[model samples]
Target: MIYNEISKVIDNKEIAENIFEAHLSSDNLSKIAKPGQFINILPSSSFDKTMRRPMSLSYQDSNSFKIIYKPIGDGTRIMRSWKEGDSADIIGPLGNAWEVSKNKEAILLGGGVGIAPILNLYNNIESTHPSHLFFGARKKEEHFIDHNPDKNIYISTDDGSAGIKGNLFEAMKSIFDINDFKDKSIYVCGPPMMMEAVRKFSVEHDIECHLALETIMACGIGICQGCTVEKCSDESSTDTYRNKYELVCMDGPIYKANEVKTCLL
Candidate 1:
């Protein structure tokens, strides 16, 4: 576990109603983190919470890190109180990263808070492949397609506030469904039900699919098994153990799309 103090907090604003984007400088962890991994944040007071909260590594440079978050409690509220120079404790680049395969064109899908991990995935892999980013939210008011748009950036919303006015699976199909990508691969990160729907779509369309699994984690490292997800024998994740559980903290947070089993669907 690695620890550090905040060197700066550049922006603090409502990215959405309760959502915020906080840019902090942490030379310590940024140097070692990979694209699809995350960090565990510890509140200043141990009396507040028993464990650290997990947040994705949105973007980072040599001396800084940026995260987009929604205020959830005293912990997040306290994080908002941090100024330009303060201390923020962090642990890890914990989890299995997305392994770049032989595929060329890749579809990166995400929605709601699940979009965090893929933001950095895009930053790291966009240059290596032709990435089409499909994002969805409840309304156009919540749509954040980043600062740049391209043939790759597509958006949709549930309330018709923005792009396609539907969910991300629909947003993706609207552009080019499974048949469109031919042999293209897909990477997904989102609510479990949403991922399940995307997984079905990818399978029906004959596209390869991978998922970034996000679950409640008391310990962002392997100890707690709070983030464990199951694997199964399938065409998509052929190497997955049929009846075994994989710890999302150590083995994943990002998993092959077919390996997961969801309680919702």
Candidate 2:
């Protein structure tokens, strides 16, 4: 269900350098919220910006939901300055959720701010399932996680300052052999380049892979005709169109790696 409500900010703090986490108290929004779903936050204070900024639900409970983000632009910068007890207009629990089968082993992959949603997925599946997180960052300080009780984490840095010397894809390839994962499921969220690499790797190995995609969205819903991703045509009628397009806001932020034309690189 989509909600447009005035939600009170319970807590807002910087967990890492330039990365902030905000906890908003909204019983209605949090109730139906799921991992991979997101909220469109309207910066009430910044009336100059007309569009809402879309943020993924990082953590959620019965009474509240959390979002982790970096203030990259004006919209998010305004959001960063917002203090606790401030009420903001928000529309969510938008987008699709991840679906996992109990029979297969799952691997959770995320890079940078993309790890926000992956964290939620890990929390839900870690208890009963065999899962691990391969997190990537540009440097050691950028690897912002305070603690991990599960200890099922693998870190990768672009520079050699952290866990693995290379990127997440390389770390993933080295840690787990592609040949060994025949029936495993991979849940990944990252930059498009990283996701493309993961998608290709999954395809080459014949592994079932799902991706949480990110794109520029003016509206969180499908009204704006924005955030379209190219997808391979599913129809049998072969007229001339080789590919179709889908809205990231409406059709997904979550899609099977095979279903979209994301990994051409």
Candidate number with greatest TM-score: 2
- Candidate 1 lDDT for residue 113: 73
Instruction: Residues 34-63, candidate 2: write the lDDT tens digits.
Output: 899888988675557778898888898988
Measured over all alpha carbons after superposition, the RMSD of each candidate to the real structure, in angstroms, is 3.5, 2.3
> Where is the poorest 10-residue window by lDDT in model 1?
234-243
lDDT of each: 0.73, 0.83
> TM-scores across all candidates?
0.87, 0.93
lDDT of 1: 0.73
Model 1, residue 237: C-alpha shift (Å): 16
Candidate 2 ranges beyond 4 A from true positions: 146-150, 238-243, 263-265
lDDT string for model 1 (122-170, tens) is 8888877888888778886776674235567877788887777688887
Clashing pairs in 2: none
